[model samples]
Target: MMQTRRKKLSEWVQQLYFIGPSLFFFSLIVLIPFVMGMYYAFTNWNGVSNEVTWVGLDNFVTIFTGDENFANSFGFTVRFTITAVVLTNAVGFGLALLLTRSIRTKNALRTIFFLPNVIGGLLLGFIWQFIFIKGFSAVGDATGIGFFNLPWLGDAQTGFWGIVIVSVWQGAGYLMVIYIAGLINIPSELMEAADIDGANFVQKLKNIIIPLIMPAVTVCLFLTISNSFKVFDVVYSLTRGGPYKSTEPVTMDIYFEAFTNNRMGLGAAKALIFFLIVAAITLIQVVITKRKEVQS
Candidate 1:
């Protein structure tokens, strides 16, 4: 019994040696900050001020009940999340399907499609900003049509669409890569057997491909949903939540509350709430998708 206990102790010591550094870093970076943020969420911390006073649930109440902008930002975030999730997944899956085929230019096309995702969001925003501001007018003049000349970032609806367009363009490629992995993982023999059984393309896709790739769909959906909810850089660079805060999303709102308005406590509260909302959404999605995956 003494020998056995010594062996187990030695094994545990070895394991701890390997894990100690990572645990230390994790505690410093994530755990500590999370605990501090949670604590500060209930206080009135003006960020730079030396004094922080406990304010209880005042920030929460203010955000949900008093602040009109918070509600507006929340509404905008919901709308953007829904639209972005749908469009990003649809386009991504479509690209995956296209690139999965054996074509001469498949590799080049894949590279081209994925290139946008590699670009920085802020840079992409600036590029699109130029397009909306200058390139659109040039197209309008050349085509003798006013379609491209509309004030994209200057109007509320147009700014919202502009954000969506940039988001879809930037994200679709990454999601496509995920979908491609899922698509390629499906057994070719299954598809061949389906074809042998006189299964048409649509029938094979609906019955075989969709079900088999349900896991990929779930991953893509989760990524898109989370990304859409937390989108900040692109919106900030492009519109700055302008046109009367029409395009302001939740993340942007939280950022402004924290830094610009110097309301760290309120901002922290908003962030906690945002985190909860995203966590709940992701959990629900995971549950539903995992069920579908099991059924498939």
Candidate 2:
């Protein structure tokens, strides 16, 4: 018993030796910042001067009761999240289906498709901004087609669609890879059995493929939703929430509130509220997806 106890003690010591540095850094970086932010959320910190007074829940109350822009930003985020999530998943799943088939240059095509995701969001936004403003106008001037010449970043509706287009282009490839993994893991025998039973492609997809790939769908949906909700850099680079705050998502609103407006406490409150909303939505999605995964 003494020998076993000594061995266990030695193992624990070895484990601690391996984990101590990581734990120390994690506590210093993540835990410390998180605790500090939580405390600051309830304080009137200007983020510049060292004077921070505890304001209780005034920031939260102001945001919920007084801030019109906050409400608008939240609504815009919701709309963007829903649209982007659906479009990203649909395009991604379609690409996955196409890439999973026997093709001459499937690997090269996959690489090309995924290349956009490797590009930085800010860079991608700037590139797309030029495309929307200059390239579209040039095309319009040359061909007399109004479609390419539409005021993409000037109009609220057009700006919304422009953001959606850019987001889908960047996100679909990453989600496609996930869907491909899920697709490839599906039992070929099941597909063969479906084929033998005279189930067509659509039928097979609707029944077997989709049902079996619920986990991947769940992951993609969660990622796309969260990403769309928190999208800031791309929008900031592309439109800067222009056309009278029409394109402002929650993150941009929070950023502008905190940094530009010098309302760090209010920004922190917004951040906390945003975190809670995201957590609640994600938890609900996870519960539903987990239930589906189990049923499948």
Candidate 3:
């Protein structure tokens, strides 16, 4: 019994050496802030004077009742999330399909496709902003393409699409890498059998490839949903939620409320609501996608 107790104590020490530090930091950085933010969500803390007063559900009531900007931002975020998620995954999956084929430039093309994702979102947005401002104008002047001459980020409609275009371009590459891994993991025998059975490319893709790659689909969808819903850096650097605040996301709204407007309590309330929305949406997406995932 003494030896067994000593062994168990040693094992627990080993486990603590591995898990204790991570748990400590996580609680410190994430859990503590989350709890504090939750407490502030029900108060009227301005973040400056520190006279935190409990206001019950006043912040939430104001958000749902009087905050038109937040509502508009919420609407914009949902629309952008849906659009970005679909386009990013579609482009990524297409790139993966093409790159997985037999071609001399396959490696080079894969690198090129994934190059955009390597750039940070803020930097990428700035780069695209310059391109939309100068590069597009120069190309339009040189090539006489009217489509390229339209104001990319100067108007509400164009600005929204401009953000979408940048987001899709930036995100597709990362998703392509995920898809490439999934594609390579598929067995050669199954594809060969499909070919021998006179299965056309489309038929095999519909019947075999898609179902088998559901794990990758789940991962990609979840990633896209969360990232798109929480997107802020790119919009900040690119548009700054500008042109009459039409492109503002909820994250930006939260930032402006807490820091810019100094409504810490309102911002905390918004942040909590935002977290719940994202968590619920991603949870639903995971459940739906996981259901489609197969054993293979």
Candidate 4:
């Protein structure tokens, strides 16, 4: 019994050795801040001040009742997330399908497509900003194509679409890599069986390829949804939550509330609400998609 206890203690020590740093940092960085943020959410603590007064639920009440910016930003985030998730996954899957075919230039094409994803979101947004504001104009003048001549970031509608386009352009390539991995994992025997059964391309895609790739689909959708919902760097670099704050997402709203307006408590409340909404939505998505994966 003493030897067994010593062995168990040694095992425990080894486990701690492996997990100690991760647990320590997670507690220091995420867990503690999360709890403190919750506390701040219930108070009126303007950041950088020592005095914190309890305001109960007033901050949340005011947000739900009177904060137009929060509502608008929430709407913007939802729309952008939905649009980006759909377009990014669809384009990524399509590219994966095309490139998985026997082709001579696919390697080069894959590299070209994935190159944009290598750049940081802020830098990519800045690059696209210049293209939208200047390069598009130059191209328009030379080619006289009205599609390229529209004001890309001059208004709310254009600004929203601009964000979507930028997200899809930068995101699809990364997702394509994931889909390519999924495609390559599919057994050759399954494709041979489908061909023997006289399945058409669309039929095979619907019946076999898609179902088999559901795990990758779930991962890509979750990633796109989270990234799109939490979008800030791109929005900051590209449009700075303009024109007239039409492009602001919930993250930017929280940032301005905390830093710009110096209402840290209210910002914390907004952030907590944002976290809940995002968590719920992503959880639901994962649950549903996981179920589909099991069924498939």
Candidate 5:
């Protein structure tokens, strides 16, 4: 019994040795701040002031009742998330299908496509900003194409689409890599059997390839949804949530509330609400997709 206790103690020490540093930093950086933020959410603590007055649910009530900017930002975020998620996944899956074939340039094309994802979001946004403002204008003038001639970022509608385009361009490549991994793992025997059974490309895709790739689909959808919802750096660098704040996401709204407006307590409330919303949406998505995976 003493030897067994000693062994258990030794195992505990080894586990602590491995996990202690990471847990300590996580507590300091994430857990503690999160707890403190929850506390601040109930107080009226202007960021710079030491006087924190407890306001109970006032911040939350104001947010739900009268915060027009927050509502507007949330609306924009929802629309952007929907549009970006669909386009990014479609393009990514399409590219994955094309690249997985027997092609001479597949490797090079994969690398080129994925290159944009590696670039910093701020830098990518700036590069695309210049392209939309200057390069598109020059191309429009040269080609006389009405599509290219439209103001890409000058108005609310165009500004919204501009962000969507950049987001899709940046995200699709990374998702393509995920799809490629899924595609490559599918057994060759399955394809051979489908061909032997005289299954057409579309039929085989519907029945076999897609079902088998459901795990990758679930991952890709979750990633795109969360990333699109939390988008900030790209919007910041590209539009600064502008064309009259038409492109502002909830993240930017929280940021301005906290730092720019100095309403730290209110900002914390907004953040908590945002976290709950995002968590619920992502959770639902995962649950639905996981069901699909199981059925497949």
Candidate 6:
């Protein structure tokens, strides 16, 4: 018994040796701040002063009753998330299908398509801002193209579509990689059998490919939903939630509330609420997609 106890203790020590550093950093960077943010959510701290007054649910109350901007931001976020998720996944799957074909330039094409995702969102936004403002106008003037001449980032409608285009361009490539992984793992014999059975491309895709790739679908949907919902850097650099705050997302709203307005406590409250909403939505999405997943 004594020997067994010593062995158990040694095993635990080994486990802790591997995990202790990660746990310590996680607590320092994430866990502690999260707990403190929760505490501050109930207070009336202005983010600068040391004086923090407890205000109970006043922050939440104000949000529910008087926070039109937050509500509008949230609504826009939902719309954006839906649109971005569908387009990103659709484009990604299409690219994956095209790239998986027996073509000489497939490898180079994959690299080119995925290159956009490597750039940072902030930098991409700024780059695209210049392109929309200057490059498009030059193209419009040179080619007499009305589409290129339209103000891509000057107004709310164009700004929304502009952000969407950038997001889809950046995200679709990463998702294509995931879908390609799923596609390559599918057994070749299955396709051969389907061909022997005289199954058309649409029939095989609907009955076999999609069902088998449901796991990748789940992952892609979860990523697109969460990323779209939490998008900030791109919007911050590109639109700045401008044109009378029409394209503002929930994250920008929270940022402005906390940092710009000096309402740290209120910002904390908003952050907590936003966290809960995002958590719930992602959870529900995962659950739904998980049910659709099939074992190949």
Off by over 4 Å in 3: none
Clashes of each: 0, 0, 0, 0, 0, 0
lDDT of each: 0.94, 0.93, 0.95, 0.94, 0.95, 0.95
TM values, all candidates:
0.96, 0.96, 0.97, 0.97, 0.97, 0.98
| lDDT pick, better of 2 and 5 | 5
What is the per-residue lDDT of model 6 for residues 176-284, given as tens digits with 9 covering 90 to 100? 9999999998899999999999999999999989999999999999999999999999999999998789999999998999899999999999999999999999999
Q: lDDT by residue for model 4 over 1-296, one digit each (tens)?
A: 99999999999999999999999999999999999999999999889989999999999999999999999999999899989999999999999999999999999999998998989989989999999999999999999999788889888898899989999999999999999999998889999999999999999899888898999999998999999999999999999999999999999999999999999999999999999999999999999999888353
The per-residue C-alpha lDDT of model 2 at residue 200 equals 96
Where in model 4 is the C-alpha error above 4 Å? 294-296
Off by over 4 Å in 2: 294-296
Question: Comparing candidate 2 with candidate 4, which one achieves the higher TM-score?
Answer: 4
lDDT of 1 by residue, 114-209 (tens): 999999989999999999999998999899887898899999999999999999999999999999999999999999999899999999989989
| Superior by TM-score: candidate 1 or candidate 3 | 3
Q: Which of the two candidates, 4 or 6, achieves a greater lDDT against the reference?
A: 6
Q: Per-residue alpha-carbon lDDT of model 3 for 47-76, expressed as tens digits?
A: 989589999999999999999999999999
lDDT by residue (tens digit), candidate 2, 180-292: 99999999999999999999999998889998999998899889978888899899999999889999999999899889989898898999899999989988998788778
> Candidate 3, which ten residues in sequence have the lowest lDDT sum?
287-296
Off by over 4 Å in 5: 294-296
The residue pairs that clash in candidate 2, if any, are none
> Per-candidate RMSD vs. true structure?
1.4, 1.4, 1.1, 1.2, 1.2, 0.9
